[model samples]
Target chain A: MAISIVVTSGKGGVGKTTTTANLGTGLALQEKKVCLIDMDIGLRNLDVVLGLENRIIYDIIDVIEGRAKLHQALIKDKRFDDKLYLLPAAQHADKTAINGEQVKAIIDELRSDFDYILIDCPAGIESGFQNAIAGADEAIVVATPEISAVRDADRVIGLLEKAEMAPPKLVINRIRSKMMQDGEVLDIDEITTHLAIELLGIVVDDDTVIRSSNQGEPVILDPKNQAAQGYRNIVRRILGETVPLMTIHEEKKSFFAKLFGKKK
Target chain B: MSTKNVKLKGTKEGYTIVLHDVASFEEILIDLEELLLNISKQNNASTEISVHVDTENRLLSDEQLAKVYQLVEQHSTMKIGKVQTNVLTKEAATLWKESENVATLVTTVRNGQVVTMPGDVMLLGSIHQGGTLKAAGNIYLFGELKGIVHAGYLGDEDKVVFAKFNHDAQVRIGEQVQIIEGKGKNEPLEDTTFAYVNDLHILSFDQLDQIRAIKPKLGNQTGGLL
Candidate 1:
C-alpha cells in the first residue's frame, strides 16, 4: 500500500507547496511511483509550481463530484517518465466543496497504484486542513525560522498529535544561516526544541527556489543547490534511508574552541 | 414553657437564633414556632426584627434552609439575616479543597494552548508565545514563561503570578493587564519577578522578597513553617 503523507503548515506563505512539489519530484527521481495531490481548493497553486498548469484538463473536484474519472484528472509530468503524477485542485471550487470522507476515498483508491502519495495541504487549521490530513497516514509540518511561522507550526503539531497520526515530522525551511548565527532569528536547535517533534530536514533560504517556481520548475530538479540537497535528504529519510543533517554554515572553529565549546 | 431545642439570644449586633445540632427536626420546628409566636404576640406588629440563624456544626440541605426561612417568615415579622453553618456539603467541601491546594502542571503549554487551574498552579513546563496560563488563584512558575499568564482569573484581585520575567509576555492579575513590551524581546529582565495587583488596582511587577510582605499567607497555608 502507498504511504500517504500530508504536507501542512498552519501559517500562510511558509513554503508548504514548494516542499510538497520538491519532495514529490525527489521521490520520483528515486524510481518510485509518486502521486501529488493539491488539496488547496479555491486557491490552487501546486499545479503552477509543478509547471503542469496547461496540461490539467480535469481537477480533483471533477473526480470527487463524479464529473471525471480519477485517471482523467491526474496529469503526468513529462520529465518523470510515468513516475510522477499530479491531481490538481479545482480553482473554481471552495474548500467546503469536498469533505474529509471524499478525500479519504480518493486517497484509498490511489493507494494500490502508487508507491507514495503526497497531499499538499493548505495553510490554516480550517476544514481544508482537516480534509487534507484526514486521508494521510503520516504528516510533514513545514515551518520557517521566523517566530510567527514557528508559533503556527507549534499549533499545527498540537492538532496533528490530537489527530493521532504517526508522530508528525518537522521541516524547518527558509533558514538563513547568517540571521541564525547572529541571533536575529530563531536557530535550528531552538526551533526543533520548541516544536518538540522529529526533525526531518532543514532547507536554506535559496533565491533560486522562487525563481525556479516562477518558471514552473521545482528547484529539486537541480542537484547542486543547497535547498535541493535538503529536499533530497528529506526524501531519502522518508524512504527509510539514514542521512545526516547537512551543515548550513561551514564556519571552522579553533581546536581549543571546539573542545571547550562556545558559550550560547 | 420555655423552648427545648431552639434558643434565642441577643448579642451586641442583633438577635441570634441558635438551632441545636442534635435536636430532632420536628421538635425543633415545633419549639421554634412556639418561641416565634410568643415573640410576635409580645412585640408590636410595626417592629420587624432580623435575626441571624446559627446552625452550629449542622449541615442543612437547600430544602431544609428554605423551610427554616419559610417558618420564620410565617410565624413572625423576624427576617433571617443569613444562615451560618460550621460544616459544609461534600460538593462544596471538594470545591473548597480544590481551590485551597496548589495544582501541579508538568506539560509544555504550546502556542494557542490555554491551561487553566482551579487554584494556584505550579508549572514545570514552558509556555510558548500565543499560549496562555490562567489560574483562579496565584501562579507559581518553575519553567520558562514566554506567553500570557493570568492570575485571579475569576476576578479575586489579590492573587499574583511569580515567574522569571520574559519581556515578550503579558501579565494579567485579576482585571488588570500589564504588557511587558517596553523591554527588549527575548530578554530576561529579572531572575525572579512577580506580577501582582497593587493597592491602586493596577498590575505591578516586583522582586521575590516583596511577595512575603505582599501576600503573607502564600506558601504558608498551614500557618507554620514545616
Candidate 2:
C-alpha cells in the first residue's frame, strides 16, 4: 500500500508548500512514483512552485466534482515523466467546495498507482486542512524556528490528536544556526520540546531555496546545495532509512560571518 | 380584547409554548397536545418532546404535572423526558456547587501491559499495546483501551472508570473483581465499557447487556490485580 502524507502547518508562510514540492521531487528522484496533491483551493501555488503553472488543465475540485477524470486532471512532471505528477487545486473555488469524503475517494484511486502521495495542506485549521488530512496515513508538521510558528504548530498538533490522527512528525524549517548559537533564535531542540513530536529534518536558511523557487526548481534537484541535501535527507528518512542530519555550519560563511568574526 | 394569544418561541436549549387567557388549564393542555401531535406527524421523527407550563403565576400540583406529562406522551413520536420546576430549593442551590468538580476517570490497557497512567492518575496520550494502567480513582481513555485496567486498585471500591473503546481487557475496580474473559469478540459495537467496585471486587457490564451475571463467590476480599 502507498503511504499518503499530509504536509501541514497551522500558521501561514511556514514553508508547507515548499516542503511538499521538495519532498515529492526528492522521492521521485530516488525512482519512487510520487504524486503531489495541492489542496489549498483558491490560493493554489504548488503548480507554480513545481514550474508547471501553464500546463494545468484540470484541478482537484474538477476531479472531485466529476467535471474531469482523475487521469485528466493529473499533470505529469516533464522532468520525471511518469514518475512525478501534480494534482493541482482549483483557483476559483473556496475550501468548502470539497470535503473529507471527496479527498479520500481521490486518494483511494491514486493509492494503487503511486508509491507516495504528498498532500500540501492549506495554512489554517479549516475545511481544507481536514480534507487534506482525511486520507493521510501519516502527517508532517512544518514550522519555522520562531515563537509564533512554533505556538501555532503546537495547536495544530493538538488538533491532529483530537482528530485521532497519530502523532505527526515535525520538520523545523528555515533555521539559521548562527543566530541559534548566538541565542538570538530558537534552536531545533527548543522547538521540538514545545511541539513534542518526532523530529524529521531541518532545512537551513539558504538563499538557494528562494532562487530555486523562482526558477520553478526545488533545491533537492541540486546535488551540491546544502539545503537540497537536507530535503534529500528527509526523503531518505521517510523511506525508513536512517540518514545523518545535514551539517548547517559546514556551508561557506556569508560576508556577515567574517565581519562579526563569529563561527557558526 | 377577547382575542386569544398563543406564542411559540425557540430558545437556545429547546422550544417554549405559551398560552394566554385560556378558558382553563384543561383547554390549554388539549390545544398543546394537538400542536405537538401535528408537529410529530409532520416531521416523521421519533424524538422525545418536552413542554414547560406556567399558569397564572401558580405552582403546578402533582396532578397537573401528571396531566402535562401524559399529554405529551400521548403523541406517538414524542414523550416527556424531563420536567424542570421553577421553584428553587436549598439542596438544588448546593447541587450546582457539588457538580462543579465531579470528574469521570478512565483507564485503558492494551495487550496486557500498562502503557499509560490509569484514569485515577492524570497522564498524557493513549495507552499503547502491551501496556497496563491502574487508578485509585476514576479512569478515562480518549482512545481505545485494549489492555488490563485496575481502577480503585487500593480497594476503595467506589471509583468508577469508563473507556471509549473497550476490547476484552481485564478490569478491576476494588477487592471484588470478576474476570470476564468470555466476552466474545465483536460483542461491543459502540466500544465503550464502564467498571465500578461492587461488594469489593470489580464488576463490569456492557451497556447493551440487559442481564448482568453477578457471581456471589466474587467478593471484596480478593485484592485487585495490578
Candidate 3:
C-alpha cells in the first residue's frame, strides 16, 4: 500500500511545489517506487520543475477521464536508481473540471503499485484544495517565516483537521536565521508555537532551490547544498526515522565574539 | 366610511386603522389607504396626525408592514404611532438571534487586510505590518501583534488590548493612543504585554502576575479558543 500525502500551504509561493518535487525525489533515491501527482491542474508547474515537461503525451485529466491508460500517462524519471514517476496535471483545463471524488478514485488506482504517492495541492480553500486532499491520508504544511505565510498555514491546518486527516506536519521553508536574530522576522520556536503543529523540517533560505527549479531539476539532486540535506531529513522523518533538525544560528558570530570581548 | 377590508377605530391617543387577516394583500392595502385618504379629507387639517396600526391576530411580513406604513405616509393627516404583531408564533424566534459581537482570527492578518469587528476580537496569529485590527470590545492576541490595533473602536474606552509579542505596533483604545516608538527594545519588561486605560492613561504592562495581583478591571471580555 502507498503512503499518500498532500503537500499544501494556504498562501501561494511558499515552496509547496518545490517541497513536493524534492521529497518525492528524496524518497525515490532511497529505492522506493515514488509517484509525484501534480494536483495544481491548469497551473501545473511540477513537470517544469522536475524537467519532465517534454515527456508528457498524456496527463492526470486524461487518465481520470478514461482518455488514456494509467501506464500511458505516468512519466518515468531515470535519475534515481529505483524509479520516480510523475502524473502531470492538464494545462488546458480549469480546476473545477475535476472534483474530489474523481481525484480520490485516481489515487486509489495508483496506490497498489507505488511505495509513496505525494500530491501537490493547489493553494487556497477552494475546490482545488479539497480535490487534492480528498484521497490524502497525511499532509505536510509548508510555510515561510513571514507572518502572512504562517497565518495561512494555520487556516490550512484547521481545514485539514476538519477533513479528518491525521494531524499535519509543518515544514518551515525559506528560513533566514540572520534576519530572525535581528528581530526582522520570526524564528523556528516562535513559528512552531504559534502554529501549534509538529514540525517536520526547515529548509534554509537558499538560491539553489530556485536555480534548480529553473533548470528543470529539484534541489535535492545537489547533495552539497544545506537545503538539500533538509529535504533528505524530511524524507527520513516521514519514513518513521528520528532526525535532529539542521542547526540555524545567528550567522556564527562566535569567532568575532571572543575577540570582541563578548562573553561566550 | 367603513370598508369590508379596513376597520378604523378611535383610540384614546388618536385613530386606529386595522386590516382584516383573511383579505387579499392588495385589497387590504388599497382599502386601508382609501380609509386614510377619507380621514384626511374629513379633517382638512395638518398633514401629520398620530395614529396606531393594528394587524389583528396576525404576523405581517416586512413587505406588508412597510405597505401599511407607506399607506399612512401617503395620507396628509396620519402619522404612525405603533405597529403590533399580536398573537405571533415562531416569527420572532427565527427572525432574530443573539447579536454578532465576536470576531475570530485563525490566520495571519495579511498586509492590506483591514479587519473591523464589533464586540470582542481574538487573534490566533500575528497581524502583518499593513493590516489593522479594530474592535468595539476587547482585543486579545494569542500570537504576535505587529500591526496597528484600535480597541473599544465603538468608543468604549474600557476595552483592553493584549499581545504576546510586539513589532513597533501602534495601539489606540478609547480616546488615548500609544505608539511603541524606536526599535521596540523597551516593551513593558514582560513576556506577555497588555494595554488598557489606567486613570485616563493608556498604560502598558508585561507584569501579568502583578496586574492579576492588583486586580485591574478588564471589562466585557468575549472570545478565545473554545
Candidate 4:
C-alpha cells in the first residue's frame, strides 16, 4: 500500500517544510519513489529548499484546476531523476482556491505512481492545513523541544483526534542534547510525556542543517553530517527497518566540533 | 370557439392555478398531452406536469373531474407527483421561528471554570504555566493568558479577540498572526486586549475592544450542567 504522510505543526518556523524536503529526499535516496508536495501557498519555500525553484513551471493548483496535467506539473529532481519529484504549490493564489476534496483527488492520482507521498502542510489549522491532511494515511507532527512548540503540537494533536486522524507520529526536531543534559532545555522524555504520541525519531540541532539549507541542499544529501545520519535513520524507521537511535553523546561532539575547527 | 380548448384558472379547495387559455378544457388537455409525449420522447428521464381547476360558477361535475383525471392518465409521461393542502402545523411554525442564528457551542475559560461552547469561545484566565488553549472561534483572553492560545481553528477567520495580557509565545488566528515572541509587556490597563488582523496589523486593546469593561466575561456559553 502507498503511504501518504502529512508533515504538520501548529506553529510556524519549527522545521516542517525542512523535514518534508529532507525525508522525501532521504526516502528517494533509499530507492523508493517519493514525491514531496508543498501545500504552503503564496509563501512557498519547498522548491527553494529543494533547489528546484527555477524548474517549477507548473504547480499543484494547475493540476487541480485541470489547467495542466499531473505529469506536466511534477518537477523531477535532477539529483534523482526517476526516484524523486516535487509538486509545488501556487505562488500567486491563496489557500482558499483549493479545498480538501481537490487535494484528495490529486493525492489519489499520485498514489499509484509513487511509494510515498509527503505533504508539507501549512503551519496553521486552516483550509490549507485541512487540504494537506484530507488524504493522508499517516501524519508526522514535527515539533521543537521548547514549551511553546510543544504546546502548539499538543493543540494540533487535539485537532487530529477530533478530525478522526489521531495519534500522529512525533518528530522532535532541533533537539539540543547538551542543553537537555545540562538542564537548559526540555528533554525528549518530557516532550513525549506531554505530547503522548509514538516517537518516530529526534533530529538534534546541527549547524549542518542551516548550512545545507543555505546551500540549497538538504542535510540528508550529506552522508557525513550527523543530522544527515539522523534523517537517514528516520527514513530507515519509516521503511520498517530496525535502526537503533543514535546516542545523544555522539551528537554533542558534533556541536562542539563545529564550534572549534570542524566544518559542519 | 371550443370552450374545451380554453385554459382555465380557479380555486380548488386551498390550491390556486393559472391555466393556458385555449378554446375548451378538452383542447387544452389535448395540447398538454402532446407536449408530455414530446418531452418523454426527447429525454429518457421521467418528466411530469399536472393541472387542476375548480370554479363555483362553472362547477365541474364529478364526471368532468373524472374526465380531467382520465385525460392526465392517458398521457403516459405525465404523472402526478403529489397533491396536498397548504396548511402548516403550530409546531412547524414555532420551529421556523427558533431556527435563526442559533448560538454556537463554545468552550469558555474564565477565572477557573473551563466551559466548552457549541460554537466558539473566549478564555479568561492567567495562563501562567506556559500551556496553550485553542478554540474554533475567535479567542478573547481576558486575564494574562501568558501561555499559548489558538483561534480561528477549523479555518474560521472572522473570529477575533481581546486580551489584557499578551505574554504568550504565540497567538494564532487562522493562518495569520503568530506572536512567537510575546508582545513584550504592556502597562496593565483597566481593560486592554488584542485582536487578529484588520486594516492595521495586530489590533491593540485600545483600538479593537472599545467596550471599556475592566474584567470581561469568559468561558463557553453552552449549558454546563455539571
lDDT of 1 by residue, A21-133 (tens): 99999999999999999999999999999999999899999999899999999999999899999999999989999999999999999999999999999989999999999
Q: Write the per-residue lDDT of candidate 3 for residues A31-139, one digit (tens) a residue.
A: 8899999999999999999999998999989987889998899999978754899999999998988999998988999999999999999988799999999999999
The positional error of residue A166 in candidate 4, measured at the CA in angstroms, is 5.2
lDDT of 1 by residue, B1-226 (tens): 2378898989898989999988987788888899988887888676788899988988877888888898999988889997887888888877887788788988778788888889888899878788899999999988777789999999988998889886568889889998877566555457698888888888888888988888787766773212
TM-score of chain B of each: 0.83, 0.36, 0.53, 0.39
Stretch of 10 with least lDDT, candidate 1 chain A: A255-264
Write one digit per residue (lDDT tens) for candidate 2, span B84-189.
Answer: 4445456755554333223433422222234333224533444533456766555665665545566667665766656655454556676665554545445755
What residue runs in model 2 are displaced by over 4 Å at the alpha carbon? A250-264, B1-121, B124-226
What TM-score, to 2 decimals, does candidate 2 have?
0.56
For model 3, the docking class works out as incorrect
User: Given candidate 4, what's the lDDT at residue B15?
Assistant: 22
Residue A156 in candidate 2, Cα distance off native in Å: 0.6
Best by TM-score: 1
Report how far residue B90 has shifted in candidate 3, in Å.
6.2
Per-model TM-score on C-alpha atoms: 0.78, 0.56, 0.61, 0.55
The global C-alpha lDDT for each of the candidates, from Candidate 1 onward, is 0.90, 0.74, 0.83, 0.71
Q: Can you give the DockQ of every candidate in the order shown?
A: 0.52, 0.02, 0.05, 0.03
User: Judged by TM-score relative to the true structure, which candidate is superior, 2 or 3?
Assistant: 3
Question: Over the stretch A41-97, how does candidate 2's per-residue lDDT look in tens digits?
Answer: 999999988999999999998898889999999999989968999999999999999
The CAPRI category of model 4 is: incorrect
